[model samples]
Target: MRAQKQEWYASWFNTPYYHILYGDRDYEEAGAFMNNLTTALSLQADSHIMDLACGRGRHSLFLNKLGFKVTGVDLSENSIDFARKQLEQDASVDSSRITFDVHNMTLPYHDKFDAVFNLFTSFGYFDEEQDNLNTIKSIKKNLKDGAYAVIDFMNVPHVLRHLVISNSKTIQGITFNMNRRFENGFIYKDIEFTDGGNKYHFTERVSALMLSDFQKYFDQAGLELIDIYGDYQLYEYDKFNSSRLIMILRKQ
Candidate 1:
């Protein structure tokens, strides 16, 4: 059954992962990651890249630093606004080399790029399975004739084996306890946030489609998975050993 996209990452992406993934040390990891990816794709600095679901333009910023013409798109208005602010503050690169736009990824894109990126398990936020399919097609639409697209996702078996079903957090002095559950391919979580003043709760769901299933979507979109990585390094994917499944797809 197809699920509805009720719990999108409009605000949640600005949480810890956002700050952690874009910080200086995080940026170093990102540089290594981009270097690995670009080498695997055999891309040059002149390549045009699209950072799909590019929250706050971190990847795009790095791509721009590498001299790639980058276009970043996301559905979060706040994130986009902040991305623009970051863009404005950046004096190291030519301002026109990097651009950020606001749009839902479940539709066709007007322009094609030499490379397309969907990092950090951003593919499954759309509740309906077809939305994911459309996102692939949309990426295909925006990919140049002989370019590549990459997606990074959590490895299901590993998560199931090492899953912490519940945990508590204190963010900015506000504490929260979270409970997680697995159903079908979705990881459901209950986030109960409590401050000294108030309490709030919310639910989030992320889908889990295996590598083979993703290949099906890639085939539907006229793409082929050329490589797979375990986490940030090139290693074999294991049901329990690998933390992530990073797949690189090329247009056929």
Candidate 2:
């Protein structure tokens, strides 16, 4: 019998090295972005929010602190476990207000939510075009009528213009050498590192989807694009100069 092939994200995200490599992500900026986003949406207190593809519950916990009930879901079991552990250790957190689960983004979550957020370039990882469409459809399925969903994606053109082909970073005593390239409508990053005398390699591949591509998916998914922003501050989207492509969609 042929063994099942593991997906890149499933293998890479489950490893402890993934967290160690990206542990320095800016929490303050993320919190500020969340504040801006929630305020813009005019979310009322106690609104139920879903953090789709939430890793380690940073945004989920913050949303809970802002008085919203939050559900954080991710495809990685290890990530969900870490999030649950964090919630368990925090005595100040209201345990009932937030929950985490392992789930595929392409599948419809059982419960609908007032708002769903997929942040930090979390979309476009699937190899199949249908998977991308399915993810949008699932997001629409998870939202109540007239409810909002945000998809935070990287601006492919801008990123390509500024792409650093090779770089190295030493974090937590581990040096990760990364080589990046854009080919065949996908951005590929090959990461190599050595730790405890063992060498490891991983690759991250994301479809280089543009605004027009997303609009097509949104239309097919029966969603309406309500707004577009370039950055976490919610600036107007500019294709040439924007750092990010943030789309706000409403279930139709």
Candidate 3:
């Protein structure tokens, strides 16, 4: 049977809350998250950074404001367009250093960056695990000799501990609903959206890949796991206490 999680976001996330959840997101929390985490990784001031799967340029713009040369890449043309529009309206401290565009995360990039970031559980999308590996391969190709990559992932244990089997919310006159259920290390999400006589629904499932799984993928992609953080506060990752896992990786 087809999983309920794949279409969950697609069907329900195109609304205003979708933009709030994914695109048009304010990264104050996430930017601070990146700042402290990158500091821990010893990121330089003028580093060339790539925000992979960057929706509406949250992290990209954040780093740009912080004086890093940043490139925001994503597969969503709609989101990219929105980001471009937003960037045009904002006055940047280092305007020339920021760029946002559409790109597939699963493919190789042209040049190397000092750092690469995939944040907010935005890394996983494909149905197959190798699909995720392809993205790791792309990241490996995008990093320079000494730079690193960081992935902000959810704490699987926390999710399991605080698993809400179902939930719902409203945004912009649209009713957004979600149902989450896990089986065999996969969290299946079923989502539905309704707005003014129109309705949509889809399913999406993400593998609750463990730290060991991250090790395997990073090793296979010629990347090394140098550090891991538990949350935005930049604390050490513990199985039960942390709500997220932030991993810092380097090319091997």
Off by over 4 Å in 1: 1-7, 10-25
| Per-residue lDDT of 44 in model 3 | 80
Which ten residues in a row are the worst by lDDT in model 3?
6-15
lDDT of 3 by residue, 60-141 (tens): 8888877788899877767778778878788764668888878878887787999999988886667667878999989989
Off by over 4 Å in 2: 1-4
Residue 208's lDDT in candidate 1: 67
Q: In candidate 2, which residue pairs clash?
A: none
Q: After the best TM-score superposition of candidate 2, give how far the Cα of residue 141 lies from its true spot, in angstroms.
A: 0.8
Please tell me which predicted candidate would have the highest TM-score against the true structure.
Answer: 2
lDDT of 3 at 98: 85
Model 1 residue 34 lDDT score: 78
lDDT scores in order = 0.79, 0.93, 0.79
Q: What is the C-alpha RMSD of each candidate to the true structure, in Å?
A: 3.2, 1.8, 3.5
